[model samples]
Target: MITIAKPGLLTSVQDLGRYGYQKFGVITSGVMDPVAHRVANLLVGNDEKEATLELTLLGPDMEFSEDTLISICGGNLSPTIDGKSVKLWRSVWVKAGSRLRFGGCKTGCRAYLAVAGGFEVPEVMNSKSTYIRAGIGGFNGKALQNEDELEIGTPSELSANISKILADQIEDKKFAEMQWTISSEFTVSSASKPDVRVMKGRQYDWFTTDSQMKLFTEPFEVTSQSDRMGYRLKGPELSLEEEQEMLSEAVSFGTIQVPSEGNPIVLLADRQTTGGYPKIGQIATVDLSIMAQLKPGDTVQFVEVSHKVAQQLYLDREKKIHQLKQGISLKIRK
Candidate 1:
């Protein structure tokens, strides 16, 4: 069990996302960076889809009521256990009554913390993700508060085995850490400025040739107005070839909609079901994780790719994840 001492900026419980009900206008609210979320869970020997605490910009201060195995991934908020530094991208065993805290952001804007058994939160619509707008799912559909107690779920067989190993290595009175850690290649680097790839949207032809060309060449700055729903980019004022009446249509994650005002809004996890604006492009699925790591004022340039290439990139990423899972399993066996 854990108790929230300070709920950092916009901390919430999220799984992969709420799915299937998007046809009925329900938003798929989940972690901004699925790669980080999944990797965190994997490090802790939990299922990838298990709920994790998604910390944005800042992180929470919590007290563990019981000793547990845990892992932190994505973003470097500089986590500490009982005032001592803790490593990310690897599992650490925290003793009961130890306080965990996060300091300034060293890189990235979001982080994910996964406990061995995952958080014990009731599922709404088959997902433990929190959709704050509707006040459903995940800790009563809201961010955690001070003094709020979170129950830990049952650990999996792998987690139990890992925990037993970590327990035997209890030296001194400090937290225990494994000598092995996941490769940095598996995690997003804090130093690199990513070149996000996108596929032409359904309304791509509506934009002028100049606008379309500039979309690839020019850099866009993420504006302060950006949120979970969408990121409003500040860049070239993209104009259409002609004005035309259009009906609202479905929009998915990473749908780049260009409104009449010419600014582009890249839809994200909590985006509305449908949109009427012209979509200039759709971000590739694999790049969405990188896109989510960008903070306001960070610049990102777009690179256009065919749908075939986009699908291949996604497949390649899945292969990497599968390889990583296999590596971890082998390490556990050793």
Candidate 2:
């Protein structure tokens, strides 16, 4: 169990996302950065889909009520246990009663915290994600606050074994992180403006040729109004070839829809099930992690890629993750 001492800005629980209910108009709420979320779980011997605490631009302060095995990934928010800095992308064994805290942001816009056993949050619609707007799922269906206590779920055999090994190295009386860690080379560092790869959307041709060129050339700034729902981007106005009435259609994560206002809205994890806006592009699965790291005021340029190349890039990423998963399991077994 753990108790929150300070709830930072917009901290919530998430997994991969809720599925099979989008036809019912349910919003898909989940971690903005899938790579970070998955890697954190893998480091702690949890299944990739297990729920993790998704920390936004800011994080939370909590005290552990029991010995815990955990890992932090993605954004670097300067996490410390008992005032000592902890390393990102590594496994950590924290002593019971220790206080964990965080400071200002360092890189990226979000981070993920995964424990050996997932958070003991109630699952709604088969997912533990917290959709705060609808007030469903996650620790009592809302963001964590000061004084809130969260129960830890039972750890798997692998998780227990890993913790048992780390326990022997805990001479500091508070916490100790493993020496080796996942390489940071694979992660997207949000230190500068990034170019996101995208494929033309199904409704791509509906936009004027100049607007299409502008998408790949003009830099777009993420607006402050953005959230998990969508990124409201500011750039050269995208105009349609001509006004045409269209029925509401299904929208997917990373759908870049150009509304009548000319600005594009890139739908994300919390996007609505259907939209009537014309989609000019779809972010490639490979670059979604890059897009997820973007924060308000960050600038981004779009790069066009063929769907075939995008699929290959996704395959390569999956292959790498598969290899890493096997490597971790083997290391733990030894």
lDDT per residue as tens, model 2, 167-275? 9999867998787887665565755878899999988999999999999998999999899999999999999999987689999889999889999999999999999
Off by over 4 Å in 2: none
Q: lDDT at 109 for candidate 2?
A: 86
- Residue 143's lDDT within candidate 1 is 88
In candidate 1 the C-alpha lDDT for residue 286 amounts to 90
Q: All candidates: CA RMSD in angstroms?
A: 1.1, 1.1
Q: How many backbone clashes does every candidate have?
A: 0, 0
For candidate 1, the per-residue lDDT at 168 reads 84
- Per residue, candidate 1 scores C-alpha lDDT tens digits across 1-334 of 9999999988899999999998888889988899999999988889999999988888999999998999999888899998899988888888899999999888888889999999999999999999999999999899888888999999988898787788889766658887788877667666455799999999999999999999999999999999888999999999999997768999988999998999999999889999999999999999898888888888888999999999998999899988888888788888
TM-score of 2: 0.97
